[model samples]
Target chain A: MSDRGHLKKTAHLAEVPAALEAGPRGAKPRRLVSTRTIVVYGTLFVAAAYYLLPLYVMIVTSLKGMPEIRVGNIFSPPLEITFEPWVKAWSSACTGLNCDGLSRGFWNSVMITVPSTIISIAVASINGYALSNWRFKGADIFFTILIVGAFIPYQVMLYPLVIVLREIGLYGSLAGLVIVHTIFGMPILTLLFRNYFASLPEELFKAARVDGAGFWGIFLKIMVPMSLPIFVVAMILQVTGIWNDFLFGVVFTRPEYYPMTVQLNNIVNSVQGVKEYNVNMAATILTGAFPLLVYFVSGRLFVRGIAAGAVKG
Target chain B: MTGQVTGRATVRAHPGRPSRLTRNLSAKIASIPMMLTAVVVFLGGTLWTVLYSFTSSKLLPRLKFVGLDQYERLWAAPRWLVSIENLAIYGVFSLIFSMVIGFMLAALMDQKIRFENTFRTIFLYPFALSFIVTGLVWQWLLNPEHGIQSVVRAMGWTGFDFNPLYDSSIVIYGILIAALWQGTGLVMCLMLAGLRGIDEDIWKASRVDGIPMWKTYLFVVIPMMRPVFVTTLVIIASGIVRVYDLVVAQTSGGPGIASEVPAKYVYDYMFQAQNLGQGFAASTMMLITVAIIIVPWAYLEFSGGRKRV
Candidate 1:
């Protein structure tokens, strides 16, 4: 096509090619499927298979009857597919005294994840706002310590947090777990929100301050509205993180209030009965469902969040 | 970024008139959680644990110092020694393999392939699952009687021995495989971001100069991605020190504590055995390990790289 014709078509579309190129990093435009293309695709396909194999096993194993699982190869398609294991995994799998199943743990995870995510994001966003916009003496030092403290293994803080929780009279309760999640989630969430708020248009913040908006006023009226995407990113992070947390859930809550991951582990690892591989796989999938859903639904935002969190260093 | 500096400058100019405490009172109140967490939980908790490591507290934390007795006992335990060794093996292999595989995957994904998003999502979805789920899935897959061993035999291979979870010697490698599976996706995503950040013109220049793709990647691309590599190394190292739940779910640190790691050691000592001092000592050692990895990196990152965005 002529340059003028190309300009005419693109000018009406009002979309620049650079804008399309700036989508997710990979996917540069290529011309032909040559030897190089075959090699690249072959390598990616093999690696993708390696990544997908366990998940496929989980799904197929979960769908099979126990007798089929016992007799057939794990790699084969189930001769007779059944959702009985899924039903059992959700309602009847045993974990010691808990014959009630993973549904109870699922509820417990919901109770823990929702409150923990909201409270943690709330505290971290406000703290991030204060750090980025309202500079006070020695703020960066605390910020640095918090970021560095994130790398401190949970082992170092686990017992100490237990003591603190006990002293506060909230030990082994859902409230204690929520508080624990908030405390641990603070560093990364705070860093995430801080960097985000820092990257915002400074003029809007300055203009709001010049209009005599106080700390909470400017935050509620201006920053919150402007940073909704960040809030979603924070929610994505915390929901997946707090939901998938086995250590804190095991450490902070009683068995009756165990999160899905903990209960799933107990149910699978408990040695009292016959090893139900199908039921075990079903329980694993059920426990993993929430984070996997979040990952698939908010795919790009999830990537952006982790990338932002990692690059903040 | 700019507003913070100007805000600081303004505060500095008017420091004496308002007095530091009253200035930005609302902001300070807002930051109380950050301050308390920083000072009390992070700084104080770490210091308190390290101090208590020298005592003989059991079932409770007491201040009657025993002068490294707990450390001596910790170092003397066979389980703790095994845990340390497992962590070393797990850490080194996980680091090397995750970096290598992650980079290779990222490089391939950068080749303008079709369905890039689909490939990325598939590669990364395993990362979304918890270690508990990862462990269980791998446990079932690695089970000798019903898993890969039996399957291979059924396919007419009479003798194929591929059971890592049962063998005490290679149990750590079993855990390592699961770790790499669950983690490398994040590393790949990070590497892809680094590759994308490179200017396209650079690739054009390399192609014009008749540089082979492998040579270009080795000599030019990898060096340009130094920061990404360092960041990934730190992230992986930190994660390696915290490999507790994966071991617990996969092998429960058995066939006889062969897959035990430091974090598991601390948890068992602190909670199960009610030996607070021993847990403190082991946890403090974990802190020391992280410090060894983090401090110098923090120095180089903050001190010499002010120009970084």
Candidate 2:
């Protein structure tokens, strides 16, 4: 009895620190601001500046002409700022036979991203719901396998996927890339939805079942409405990952359906030519515009989604 | 009474056990399409790759058994060795630096400062950009003649030489820094979420007790975020292993294979070098190495009987 009492006390002691660090249980205290706060904020300001420096340099360089770039005070305002580089990068930066720049790959990326995101998210939601709510033999085994698949590096899978796609006559097509993204996106998306669903009141699902709602009906009525936040989060992650992808896009897609990332790569990563700084910076900014816009607009919601997923997972 | 009525109704509706069994069987049958997708796409694809790594193939993937010859050649290749070394250096520095910077940023952001969203968006915006574009931007920004070097020279402080991208000895470090720029924001976001989820009451109690902020964070807050740290570490590890695009975009393993990474080496052999057999062998070795490192960690995670993101 004494030993058990001691163990309980030790556990209680552990809980105390946890509660203390989480801040006083209730009510905001009167301001007793410390110098440490200033120090912390100051450090953050400096770090933010460092993080923003590369972007500043990219923007400034992109605005400069070749002559100004050559003269190169990258931090200073360009002696003659020009949007000519942006125009050239948009329409005339050479990759191969066509000099029509990254604009060509824009629609190709869109066509790939939209359908892939929807299908993957839908499939993942179904898988998550079934795994969490339905009791079936070998369910845990399937979930384990899916989770393990996430750890396998894409490099290991690339050769085989290429062969399989080739065998099916779908290699180097936009459809092939879509399938690849969907397969890769499954583990993370499934994990997200599964955890989210598990956190929801189990009684809600039980009550739905009592109402004679079948599997699809219960999922659509109860789970889908509650899952809006997570769905948006999944979409954000997929759009960013799919749009920014270069290796899979380059290797999987034929030259005709190459995404903007490939064009951006060709423009800036030119090996044998006179390196064009202005064009490279402009191309990069142009290519990155979409995802950056998404993040900028939905910044708060994105953070909240991440926080919710983190806490629940 | 209601339970009896439902039980009788269920019995009356189903009537025969054989028909009930068939109904259950049909439901199972209806689920086959979903199961088939999971199996064919994930398991089948993985198995096919493992099988191909054993074959002697090139360019358009010819399948003929060639024992361990390709693996032998891969182990002996100088460029492949260089690629392995570069990746090791890049992975360690990038992971450490990004984690440190990200954690620091998150701790600061949790202090409830002004313009929190602006700061967050600024830090995280890079993660939204494709590394292909970011890598190019870095390449241009780091160029010897036209970038930081020229800018410094023109400022009349001609001794500022920051041309690691062109230098054989220091080029990989340049790539690592660029990768860190793109990666740190993701770490910050993940860690910030961890920080925020930390109950607010702890801050107040610590303050009331006069436990200094740094000490409180170090001893109390950081320990509570173990799961978040694990998730971030795994994600970063995967990123490190598959780090091909940025290198290709930024340096092309340039200045005589200075910044070559293992993925790029495998890619070159598979496509440009037209030695698919050796490429597969290199990939097999990488898979083995990654598995050796990851399997134990994965086992521990799963063995805890919890699903981890």
Error of 2 at A222 (Å): 3.8
**Each model's lDDT:** 0.88, 0.76
> For every candidate, what is the interface RMSD in angstroms?
5.7, 6.2
Model 2 stretches with alpha carbons more than 4 Å out? A1-38, A271-274, A304-313, B1-34, B60-63, B197-212, B304-309
Lowest lDDT block of 10, candidate 1 chain B = B1-10
Report the lDDT of model 1 for residue A258. Answer: 89
Every candidate's DockQ is 0.49, 0.39
lDDT of 2 by residue, B133-208 (tens): 7787788778777677887777798898899998999999999888988878878999987897887668666755
- Model 2 lDDT tens row, A1-313: 6954774565446556555776776323323345666787788788788778888888888898888777656777777788998998888888867678878888888988988888878887877777777645665666666776777777777777787788888899988898888777777777888888888999998897688666677778999998898889888877877888877887788888998888778767665577777888888888888988887877876665544332211
Give candidate 2's chain B TM-score. 0.86
TM-score of each: 0.92, 0.86
Model 1 C-alpha RMSD vs. true structure (Å) is 6.3
Binned by DockQ into CAPRI classes (incorrect, acceptable, medium, high), candidate 2 is acceptable
